[model samples]
Target chain A: MWHELARPEIWVPWLLGMAFGILVGSTPGLTATMAVAILLPVTFHLPAMAGLAVILGVSFTAIFAGDIPATLLRIPGTPASAAATLDAYELQRQGHGAPVLLTNLFCSAIGGLVGVGLLALLAPQLARWALRFSSFEYFWLGVFGLSLSAVLTPGQAWKGMAAAALGVLASTVGWDEVAAVERYTWGRTELFGGLGFIPAMIGLFGLAEVFRSASHRLARRPDARLEIRSASSRALRTVLAHPRLILQSSLLGTLIGALPGAGADVAAWVSYGLAKRLSRRAQQFGQGCWEGVVAPTSANNAAVAGAWIPALVFGIPGDAVTAIVVGAMLMYNIRPGPNLFHENIHQLHLLLAIAFLTQLFLIPAGMIGILGFRLFIRLPHSLVMSAVVVFCVVGAYAIEQKWFHVMVMFGFGLLGLWFDRHQVPVAPFILGMILQPILELNLRQGLIKSDGRFQAAWERPESLVLMILTLAMILGPAMWHVVRRIVAGIARPRTSESSP
Target chain B: MFSAHPARTDETAAPGSNRGARGGVSEPTWKALEWTVVGCAVALTAWLAGGGRSALVLSPGDPGPWLVPWSAAAILAVLAIGSGIAGLVGRRSVGAPREQETPARPAGRWIVVLLSAGYIVVAPVIGFGVATVVFVVSFLKTTSQRWRWWSAVVAAVALTLYVVVLFEKLLQVPLPRGSIGW
Candidate 1:
């Protein structure tokens, strides 16, 4: 690994990929998935290790660059950065854009390093543990994740749950994954493949923000400038003060990211919710709290590393990005799984080293991005919003070469507008769309394996443990409220009786 | 310089004002809308459930296709109905004030939406590049009175060319092209 890093061949592509990733990511409607897809063909010409390095650099840098837009424009460049928009945009509104950007960069690097360390140290043990998880356990995990996302949203929990239900219904639009039965295509060939998640995401976050800006008539301030030196000092102090949060979010992100279907988006959302739930200053979370920005930013970057664990160890892609990586590996005549560990251990080590080197390169890459994109913050609002609309159209169309997708984008844009007006959170809806198929597939598979007996499915120790945790996650907050009420009632003064 | 405080004159400012005011929907109306949403969900699930084996398609060991969707819809319906009722009862008990509503700003939003829809419809006919130029210039001019025609034209031309060159020429992702190839 050390020898590989010393070579210019390894580091040069990493640097160039990082630079390209930042440009693609900071643009609204352009996603990490699109970046990887666009660059994957180019990597085919390079050596396998160098190709892997470029992909790693792109994925890592793109996730961080997403925060740039989320903070500056209240638009999440990628789904993973959606949570960052909650507080990061608020901080930006409070004239803390420089600090927020700086914090995002620093914590993202720290989180990536921590994730790489965990991937290096604990891959085997964690893979073994993950193997113990059956479909029943996954079902519970999916429900728990979806429920937490719905309930932890800032406004009415029921509204969020309703939106999630709608999203799940949307997910069921195509043929069933297991049954091969056409469910809700309504006889249209385009509907057979179902709604593309990227198009829907582009519509919901990107186009919706355009509509919002139009209504509010938001104008960019020409005088706004990034104060990097002063903001960097303040951001450094803020991050240093919360050492525990940094560590906890990183670990949690790694764990969630290691789940086969769960990716950085889920890791970021779950970590952000957990931070808000556990923090002493919870009320300040959506009101520009630095902890809010730190948790998700760190978790998302760490998740990039965590995603590599399953991809290398078990040939299971942790997320969409790794799914693409698996394809790239196959193209290079290198297969993943246990046999690869023995036959191509050197490549595995190279992959790990590339992941670490990408983090090392993030510092310079992120600084360049922050400095370069500051000019974007000062651009006229009309011009910026106009560009966003154009990108949204192109991005949605580029996902699949069909005009139907552009229509889907427009339809979801209207839905998103309604959601925004009603104060319903969009994150849970996206989570539902992502997790619904997985949950349903696992549920049916578990039932099949258990001979259609619920008891049999629950008999496994892992299943029972996950079931208990799901129950606790669902009911624990209500129970705490009850307990607090009881304590308050008992502690009431006797003068209350006389007054009554 | 002390003087008697002026009497409050806003009727909606008084306690227990339930009527729709300042563009805000009344409490009962809001509750009705919630119930309507719940009702639609229940009706859709019921319709789906009525299809039974034909629509659901259960295999030898599978739990069936409609099971998860039906169950999720049922749960959502129950939660929505429960929340609607609870909101009504809670509002009565707490005497919560009606929410203030923002003044309607529908024209700009509607124009943008209409322009976007038109752009999509026209893109296939006139080409994506030409339609984009029209949409950008029209959208900017419609949304803001301060926008100069030359500025809008310049922005529209630059953006269309950039997207066409990057996506079409470089990435080789085929974009919609009409009679005029470029």
Candidate 2:
């Protein structure tokens, strides 16, 4: 893997990825999808590995850097990194920029390493197992993924279910997955195939953020200036002192990463949740807490690495970002799946080596970013925000050269803005959108395999376990809430009497 | 509308007061208006869904694209209903105005909205390149670059060139060419 690092073809992707990563990461509306989309035309001229290198590299770094503005300013750069706001901005206010950026870089690197390691280890086994999966299993897998999303997003569970239902319904547009008969497409040829993911992503994540950003006429709070009073060594020591926290988070990140379709935001939230529950100083979490910073920062980065395993081993993109990577791989005539490792072992090693090296650059790159944040942050929010909106529009249009995609982006952007105002979570919506098609495709296939018997979902132990987990995911939260309410009710009289 | 608890003057302080007292309506009045808007939205969603499946389809399809549209309509209906309910609930609980804080409105809001609307309106007519150049320049002028007229011009020129040169020239992504020539 190390030997492949110096190859010129490797550097082509590396440079391209780094430049695009910085651009997309810096921009609010231009997501990794749009970045890769604009660059997709560029990939036509390059080899598969080199192309994949550029896209995946951008995907990884862009996602990492997306948190910068979110931390420095209140704007969440990417939908996936929005979770950073709860603690990151607070840390910035507390003058923890040096530590926060250092932790982000360190944790991201560690998480990526962990993710790559897991991808190397688990993807082949999962792929082999996936081959045994019928349509029924796929359906269950889809359900399981959605259920986990609902379980993970930090808000009303019903809202998540609502978002997931909407996504499933959206996927049901155009045609039925099995019969290939047109279903909800209306008369539009674009609808004949259903809503494209890139437009939807750009709309939901990009255009929506643009509109929402417009609502906030951001004033230059003099504090928006990037101030790093401490050194990197101090930040490094603080993170190292929390070894247990870091290890737990890295593992959590890897696990979330491995989950098909679950992205870094989800990973961060899950790790944050765990970190809060397990920490001795759990109450301090929203108030410049480093563990709060470490959990999501590490997990999300790791999730990026984790996303690759399924894409490489099973040919199923774990997330939208990796879908681009998978697409690049296919362009090279190098098919994904277990055979990919054996057939193009050198390329796989090269890719792995590149992933490893991106982390090493983090120290220098991140330092430059920290120093530049003041100047970058000072750019008029109106102009930057407008650019973001344009990027989203152009990006959606570029996805398929259709106006409908742009429309979808705007529609979703409005919806996202509304949800933000109402405190309804957006995470589930993203998960639902990502997982719905997989669920629908799998469910129908599974049903066909099982001769329309629902019981077939339980026939396989793995499927059954996944189903149970889904149910548990739903019922556990409800049960806990009910129990808490009941207990509180029971204690009300006693507490009132004692207080009086 | 349930008016069990009348809004006090201070509860009305939220939105209008937050806007520095020039806001047209009292805080309580705005809250009521917000409720009405939410109620109207719900009614609209229900109305949209009232028709048969074909009526639901925004596009049209075999088996009808109404399935998802109807689903979205239903969700939106529910959300609207919930918003109205929450507004009423907020009114009841606080007995005063329930404070719903929005982000401080910057002067840039109107400019941005207008600019964006203009961009969308002009993009197809003038082509992306031309429309984009105007939009970027106007945007920079409206925002932080008052003394730096050249900065706006430079940014607009540079951005257009960068996108055109990169996507069109090198990447060959087929950007919209203006009818007015290069």
Candidate 3:
């Protein structure tokens, strides 16, 4: 894999791409999708490996870059950074700020390696057959992912589902992108862009958190001055302690990422939820537990790698970022689809190598980014909170320089406060918003083609599997108790009879 | 379907038991809050869903943009209503109230939220830069005992300058200039 990349032309663009990924991804309102799109024009003159190096480099690093803000500030720098905000921020506030981020960075790199490794080993098999998914399969895929919201909630499944439905409703504020039909915008031009995602996110995760943490006790917290000294060794030791967790999260992230319409955000949530469900220390989740920090960090970056699978194999984007990458590939005359492997097997292999090696650069690049932010965290607690508010205002405003977006941020901030007070899990609400477009688009398309038969969602083999999974998710808890009771009842009688 | 309020005393109530309800209103309060939020969502979605059909309605089955939201609203309403009924009867949260460890100041949270909301409302009118300075100074002076008013003013000015330089000069974002300007 290293043999072909000896040329400067390849590695230079790769480094540039990773840098751009860090810039856009760490900055609020900018996205990894934007970074790749910006670099697409430059890839035209580059070699296939070089072009892939840039695109793949940006996606992988951008996913991790979001964690910088997520860990240091309570705000998620990117949508995928939502899960990272949970444990990393908790750990940061616990005076393990420097170490948690470094560990998270390593986990991201490890996750990237796992993703690229799987991509190399499984791409041929997956691309050849498993990607025969269509609208029917996609509609089910959307539902399947949506069902995972149940897993996301620590409370009732119904609450999660309702919250998710609310998220879908929030997404409905704008015009239907495909149909171009006006929705609940109510003649307001500002509403056409829908509720600004960045504003809503900053409100829900960032400002809402700021408000919740507004205690006088919080005003006098210690900075990470001493922790920065031992950050390196601590991070190394922490990453070393969690091989099984890292592997599980990465694998889960890769598989979810490989699914079209599901991206790093969903993968992170599902991975976190799965880890929580399986952990003996599940009670420690969201309270600065290392598993909480590791699971989503590893998963989100792995998801970046996973997203390339459907894009390279099925000509369908695995997420928003891959949609741009697919376009960039086509611009370089690298057509993707069923015939992609047959046409350019060597090119594909080189691209995978570039992606795999992209993880190596993530460490130095991510360390520098976090260390830079570490300086900002040295400020007193009051000043840091003030700075956060300033940044949130600017970030929300910088999106479109519109006060309406700022208002949207404030409105969602209020809502988030209310949700926090009321004990509603806002995580599902975000998932719903992200998945609504994919779910509705595919469902409507499937129905229109299948003549409005509700059963059309499960007509395909893939759809059938997803349908079964969704049902299992919804019904699994109820059935589990019944089975346990029945077995206990049978065993009680047998034991008594034998004893007598 | 249930409350997400913090567990009362970590008394370790059994699942589905009303021990939380007996101890405090945390159980009923949460259920009330859940259905209320869901109820509001139902109203908003139902209202929007009714109006979702634009001129792009292709057919009866293909309700165009109306279907997704309308269906979501219907489902939410059903779930909330059903859950409300269940709450009225007997069902409740499955676990103990979540334990909350973060030290909370009821007053401080409101202060931060009010100051932030005020900043948002006044930024465009008062110029983003100036509004930020006032907001930061006021917040620091009011909230933190470490900084006196004069020191708070100094820090606020410095912070505001950094924001202006970063956004307006370096990044070249055209920030709003109110009557006070720069």
Candidate 4:
């Protein structure tokens, strides 16, 4: 593992990946998916490790960088990084120094290292355990993933479930993955498959925001000029002070990332949740607490490193970015999966080394970003919003030649605006839309394979544990409320009856 | 159907619960918005159920696309009920409106809504770039800009390049050129 960390062949590609990640991550509509897709054309020419390194670098950087605009502006750079909106911006608003940004970068780097360490130490065991997840287990896993979102979202669990249902509905709008039956495209040939994730993301998060902004068009302009004043040395020390949080978030991130389809977003959210729960200063979290920045930032970047664990060991692409990298590998005639590790150990080790080194480029790029935030913020909202609108139109058109994507983008923009107006959490909707299909497809196929025995899901302990976690997720908050109510009732004075 | 004070006391400040009831004028608008959301959720749920792989399920059907959305609708329904009951019981407590000291100069809130709605309707027809520039310029003018003509020209040129070069050339995604034949 240490030997893989010292190779020069890895450094070059890693830097390239860092640059790609920061650039894509900085932009609003261009997600990690588009970043990976854009790099695919270029990556095809590189050596195997080099190619995978670039993709991985881009993926991690983009995921972390997505927080840039989300914090600086209210625009989320990527769908997965949306949760950063609440806490990150709040911190920025309160005038926390630039040390927070540097700390986030430092923690991200540390988290990446920790996640990589976990992959190196634990992926083999996890992969072996994962082998037991047959179709039935996978189906349960899918349901559990969707349910987990509901659990994490605040408010009525039923509402979260409803958002999940809406997401599942959104997913079903495209073609059925296995049988190719048209689910709900409404007769357009484009409907033959279903909604593309990229376009939907652009429309929902990007254009929807445009419409929402249009409503308050002439209200007080946002504070675009943000100045951060923290030295790197001081920021680094502050991050070190919170070693426990760093350790916990990194470990949580790796665990979430190692799960086949759960990506950095889930890991980050989970890490944020854990950090909030564990912190003595939890109330200060969304108000720009230092821990708020550290938790999600670390978990997401760590998840990026952890993503490769599943991708490398099991030949399963961890998330959309890894999935694209897998496609690039197939283009080179290199098959991924369990056998690839044995067949391509030297190559895999080289790629791992490159993944580690990508942090070098990420640090400098992140520093530059911290310095540049002020300038970026000064740019007028009209100009920024106009550019965003242009990006949405082009991005929609690029999804396919069809003009219908524009309609889709606009349509979802309205839906997204509606969702925002009501203060419903859009995270579940995105999570459900992204994860439900994977869960459903795997389950339906598993059930078909198993001949209708629902109990088959419990055969795999991993599946069983996840299922239990999902149940706990639903029950935990409700239980808390119930317990709180009971305690309050008990604490009430008996004299209330006499007084009344 | 229980009612509470219109203004919440300090003792009742729970973390995850709604605060004291809003004023009567605002209450109905919020309630209307809540029910509107529920209506959309239910409509979406029905559409999902109608298009399900298996439609023979009970009222508590399979956890398809509809199930989640329908559940959201149910939650909203609960909120709506709570709001309605609050509105009814707090009718007597509905505080009188504060009198304005002078003749009011309207802030043009409806015009803002109309302008946004108009922008959306015009976007596809005029092309995003053109429509966006026009909207921005018109918005600035409506909000009391002195240099409307200059703003319009500058915004148009800048937005066109943004749409053409950045989006079309660099990203290689096409946008509607325009229905006006531009």
RMSD of model 3, in Å? 8.5
List per-model TM-scores for chain B: 0.68, 0.60, 0.71, 0.55
Better of 3 and 4 by DockQ: 3
The CAPRI class of candidate 4 is incorrect
The runs of at least 3 residues in candidate 3 whose Cα sits more than 4 Å from the true structure, single-residue gaps closed, are A1-108, A119-131, A152-155, A177-181, A219-358, A365-377, A489-500, B1-34, B37-41, B44-56, B59-61, B86-96
State the lDDT of candidate 1 residue by residue for A88-170, as single tens digits: 88887777888888899999999999999999888766555666677887677667767766765556666667777777777
Interface RMSD of 4: 13.1
Q: Residues B1-182, candidate 2: write the lDDT tens digits.
A: 00111111111224524423225543433443453465356445444533454333232222232333455546545644554565455543211232444545445445665676677667766788888888888777765445277777777777777767766676555666557554
Tens digit of per-residue lDDT, candidate 2, span A288-311: 788888788778878888878766
Tens digits of per-residue lDDT for model 3, A1-500: 57778789888888888876886577543456545544554455567678888888888888898887677556576778899898887777766777887888999999999998887778788667745777777667666656665454556677778777887888788867666677777788889879955577667765776676675353211233434447889988998998999999999999998875567888999999999999999999999899998999999999888878866775555665675566557657887765788788888878877887789989988876665544543456677677767777776777667889888888887887777655676757765776676678778888877777888777777889888988897789879979999999999999999995
Output the worst ten-in-a-row residue range by lDDT, candidate 3 chain A: A218-227
Whose DockQ is greatest here? 3
Candidate 1 Cα deviation (angstroms), residue B63: 2.2
The CAPRI quality class of candidate 1 comes to incorrect
Off by over 4 Å in 4: A1-103, A154-156, A177-181, A215-249, A252-300, A303-355, A453-466, A479-500, B1-148, B166-182
**lDDT by residue for model 4 (A58-92), tens:** 87788777877666555667765666666766766
Give the candidates in order of TM-score, highest first: 2, 1, 3, 4
Looking at candidate 3, what is the lDDT of residue A449? 79
Off by over 4 Å in 2: A1-10, A23-48, A66-100, A175-177, A219-232, A235-242, A257-296, A307-353, A454-461, A483-500, B1-101, B106-114, B141-151
Worst lDDT 10-window in candidate 3 chain B: B1-10
